[model samples]
Structures are given as structure tokens and as C-alpha cells.
Target: VAGQFGKSAVAAAPTLLTKELTFNFQQKRSIQLAMVELEDMPVRSEAEELVFSLLIAILPERLPEQTQLLSNYPNPFNPETWIPFELSQDSKVSVTIYNVAGTPVRNISVGYLQAGSYVSQLKSVYWDGKSDTGERVSSGTYFYQIRAGDYTETRKMVILK
Candidate 1:
């Protein structure tokens, strides 16, 4: 690959790169690949310049293109609710619920989730109207925020009990 990095023009010996990737997904995706390989083996950066591109990125079906926090199900609930969201890339997900007064009422540790749509009930986070200390919460209006990679969003929900 030959292109200007910034102000310097860099070129290298012509080498072939075989990359197999398919991403049939919803709108909104970012994909970039850069590496150096020679004859199915690794090559020093000083030896070559190449950019890898996938084929499925041009299609549309299997992956998510951006991170997002969708609305929760049964927003006005009795004692529990499910939070559904999606990620554009692999990330350590963290969910925190805050009361109307802007104080955290519950913190959900979601650990790691792969890049995809987690819109289904089974894939979403479940909060049993309880705080981190495992006590029931008196709810009217509450805020739920999710942190996935560099993306964050907060939505409102109600507990009718």
C-alpha cells in the first residue's frame, strides 16, 4: 500500500494479503484493518505496507455498526425490568442505575460483551428493583446508564410499585 501518512509518502514492495471477513449488518459501522504478513507468516513493518478490507462490510445482515442503549422493556414495572442495548465492538460493559435525585441506586457489572445486537430479553440486563446492597428500591422515576467502550447513553424508566 502506498499513501501519505501525514506529510511523508510511504511505499513498499508489492505483496499480497489474503483476508477473509464478512459483516452483514445494520447501518452504521466502522472497519479498518492494518497489518503486515508474508507468505502466511509475519512480516516486519519496515518490510511492507498493507491495508486489509473485508467483503461483508459492503453487504447487510449479521452485525451491528454502532454502540447503543435501547429502551428497556416494561418501563413501568412492579419489581423488575430488562435493559436492552447493542455494541459496535467488543467492550467491557457497565450498567448503573440512578434515582431521580441523581444518586446511584444500583450498579450492574456486565463485564465483557461481543459486538452485536443485544436487543432480546435474554441478552439484556435484569434489575430486580434492588440496589447494589440487595435491597428493594422505592421507585417512581429512575435513570439507567450504560457504558460500552467509548459509548454511553442514559434512559428513563418507572417502577409502579
Candidate 2:
């Protein structure tokens, strides 16, 4: 009788004590059903524990690695230069040239490479002083950056016409 009156009043007082009791009762019923089936699958927890133990035992034996790029050549070049770098891991690499004002002028590399040292020639790219679209670039300082994996490095060069 009381449960029926409480259920009818729930349409108006949605958060009455009876509604709270009903929600908790359903949750307890579901938990009881789940526990009734747990005895057949105890190995899941054991396997998870074993994997975690192995990872803890082996992870400390590894070392951190680093990647680097040696400074470029012909630092103050007229029409040509060279940029070199080394990668510690196989990575997607990009080398970009930018003017003193930080605008990208040329893309020297936009490709993937294996781990090793490499050199790139900047022949058609050097300042006869010209831009990528072949407009005459002014004599000024320019910068280039090499990006390999998670590493990045920048260096400056000069253009003299």
C-alpha cells in the first residue's frame, strides 16, 4: 500500500526517498548477478597481474635515445649551400628555409627517411637572390630548420648577390 502511494507520487516528486531506494535496490541486484558468475573466470585478473609484473621487471633495462643535426655548410653562400643531419630512428623528415622575417621560402625535404646521417644540397634554392616562385630575393639573412621525428633544429645563413 505505501509502495503504491510512493510510486504514484514519484510522477510529481521524482526524487522522493522511495525512488532513491529503488535505484539502489536495482544496482545491488545487478551486482549480485555479476558475482554469481565470477567463479568461472578468475584467470583474467591473474593474467593482468602477470603482464604488469613482467612489464615492471623489463622496462628499466632500456635507454633513451637522441637525434641531432650538424650545422650546415657554406654559412654565407652566394648560389649554393649544404645542410646535414642525423636521425636516431626512422622518421618523417622536413627541412624548410625561411627568410629573416620567418616566412617559409623553400621546402628542401618533405619525405620519410631511415635512421642515419644525410646531406642535402641547396643549389637551385640558394640566393642568386631569388624566391621560390623565382622572384629576385633581397640580400639578407635567412634561416633553415630541420625536423626529424620529435627533434627540431634551426640555423642561419647569409645571401649575397
Candidate 3:
């Protein structure tokens, strides 16, 4: 039976299935196993009666585009929230938090980053709803701006005390 399929045929069968399969991970900083269903296959020979299970390690997808300043998560947060961003290439990055009155509260300098996508959980860059002086800021709407090379963007976030 194995001779009919050949060793390479059995070994490479899983690779062919993955070509039509897409993986999606819902959580950050976590590993999960998900079963995917493939299209129905027709049994051609007795050798094909052998069943095989394939396991593929999935990773987060990447967005290879221009620099982007993504929004902070858990908005209307009490103390802290995550900030995520993406860099298409290596560049100096800076993130600043400002109050509604247009005053800079905290400045986070990322310095230099390579070209890739970055998430707060992976990068550990978060805002603790505090000013640079280590004092907690009032609850309200705030803005965060990212300056990376010549690519700049501003986004709004909410803090709920």
C-alpha cells in the first residue's frame, strides 16, 4: 500500500492541503491549535484508505505597507491600554500622548524599529494613563501621535477613571 503512494506522496500530501488553508489567531501572545476542514477527497485506491492528520503552526499575518499608527485598545480604560503600530521599514519612531487641551502628557521614544508589524503585547509598549511626571491624568478623550520618519499619524483614545 505504501509503495503505491510512494514516500514522497504521503509526506507531501499535507503541504498541498495547506496551500488552500488560511490560519487566523484571535489572541495575542498565545498559542492555539485549530482544526481546519479540507475539501472532500475521493478514495482512488486501497492505499488511500490510510488516514493522516496534519498539524500546521500558525503565525500572525504581516502587513507590508507604509508606516501606520494604529489605535490604542481597551479604550475608555481605567489605568492602562495597549498601543500597536506597524513599520514598513526601519525608522525612528516616537509616540506621544496628549490631553484634550493639546498638552503633551507622555512621550515614548521607540528609537529605531525594523520593517514589520508590531503589537503591544509583543512589543510591551503601553500607556498607563499617567503623565510624564508619574501622575495619573484625568479621564477623558486623549490623542496619541506617532512620528516615524516622514510618516506621521494621530489617533484618539478615551480614558475612563
RMSD in angstroms between candidate 2 and the native structure over all alpha carbons: 21.0
lDDT for position 101 in model 3: 90
Better of 2 and 3 by TM-score: 3
**What are the per-residue Cα lDDT tens digits for candidate 2 across 60-93?**
1221135676666776777666777666567788
lDDT of 1 by residue, 22-127 (tens): 4332322343212112223455353333232122222223455578899988879989999999887889999999998999989999999877788877989998
The 10-residue segment with the lowest total lDDT in model 1: 9-18
User: Once superposed on the true structure, which residue ranges of model 1 sit more than 4 Å away at CA?
Assistant: 1-60
Model 3 misplacement above 4 A: 1-63
Leading candidate by lDDT:
1
For model 2, where is the 10-residue window of minimal lDDT? 55-64
| Local distance difference test values of all predictions, in order | 0.71, 0.59, 0.70
Q: Could you tell which candidate, 1 or 2, scores higher by lDDT?
A: 1
Please tell me which predicted candidate would have the highest TM-score against the true structure.
Answer: 1
Residue 71's C-alpha lDDT in candidate 3? Answer: 69
Candidate 1 total steric clashes: 4
